[model samples]
Target: MKKTVLVFGLLILALLLMFQFSKYAVISGDLKVELIVASIAIVFFFIGVYINKKTLQKPNTPIEEISHKRIKELDISNREYEVLQKIAEGLSNKEIAQSLFLSESTIKTHVSNLLVKLDAKRRTQAVKKAKSFQIL
Candidate 1:
């Protein structure tokens, strides 16, 4: 019957798989110990590197507080501030427009206004100015 042949075929495949696996599993005693020792050495090496890196790292300084007074002096509007934040995140005007659900032309106007307010000729300059003022 087809069922009997299928069962025998499956049995033969299972035996072949076990035989192949046994060949890999039957490593020499010395080789097994060497592999375990090598694995342990690799783990310890990584641990030592991690500890060294941690020890060499400088303590992180607290982020500077936002300067509302400077921001007020800059006279940047709330919506323009939102646009500037997007600029700081490196989003293009089209991407910002899609994210804020506004038209691309509207986003372009916002970017143009931001550039004037920030006294920068380009998006990168505007972002730099905003970040320097801590208004980002």
Candidate 2:
């Protein structure tokens, strides 16, 4: 914690120094317009980086783009498919059970079976794979 505070303090001090130096340089005409342009370019570079990161975080796969071959090959049961749809809708086991008129344990079993069929270790992963396969 102390190390973190120390580092942050140093960074703050450096920024203050840079700001004062830049103010002096600009007033003295020591900083050129080229430097201003370069700073703008750097700001835009960081903005582009942030936008690219956000874009990459979201998948762009449309439903029409998802292949159906693996979906057909998986041959999931009708009930399992229903459970998968509920999972895709972001329902919890208890909610799914209530909606489907089944016990929570039964819903859990179906979720487990669906995971095995989809070869996924987590519920979210199973749903993503199912969507990618156009099964949901």
Candidate 3:
């Protein structure tokens, strides 16, 4: 979604530049005025982007807060943390079982246990929460 927006934004900017600069070659009049205006506008645009980045640079740790909250919220087991590590590495239950030498049914049980203990509706949510709590 962001890529589409970025591509469209660049297209609009290119079109606008063509309209402004192309006027000079055909108009047969003083192009100095147009050049000056465009140059100043571009400089101001860059400066505004610089200032905006600086304004958004405050540092904080949301992960630590989530760890505290999750310790109270989650009821994880030893196997659940193992399941989370596998999920974080983008493993399916069968693949995790293959690595752990467990049966597919056992892996499914551990996954279900992880989901309930972490108060997650799904495996993806459980993995995300585990990362948030630094448990995986």
TM-score of each: 0.62, 0.50, 0.46
Global lDDT of each model?
0.78, 0.80, 0.74
Root-mean-square deviation (CA) per prediction: 16.3, 8.6, 6.9
In candidate 2, what are the lDDT values of residues 1-136, reduced to their tens digit?
A: 7965875586568567666766777889989767855775675576568657865796776547544566568977778888898999999999999999999999999999999999999999998888777666
Alpha-carbon RMSD, candidate 3: 6.9
Measured with C-alpha atoms, the lDDT of residue 89 in candidate 2 is 93
Q: Residues 1-89, candidate 3: write the lDDT tens digits.
A: 79658755875786677667757644766565667568657865875686578669988855443354454467666666677778889
Candidate 3, backbone clash total: 0
Please tell me which predicted candidate would have the highest TM-score against the true structure: 1
What would the per-residue lDDT of candidate 1 be over residues 1-136, giving only the tens digit for each residue?
7965875586568556645544555463333655655655675576568657866999999888888888789888778888888888889888999999999999999898888888999899888888888887
For model 2, the superposed segments whose C-alpha errors exceed 4 Å read 1-69
Candidate 3 at residue 64, lDDT? 43
Please tell me which model should have the higher lDDT, number 1 or number 3: 1
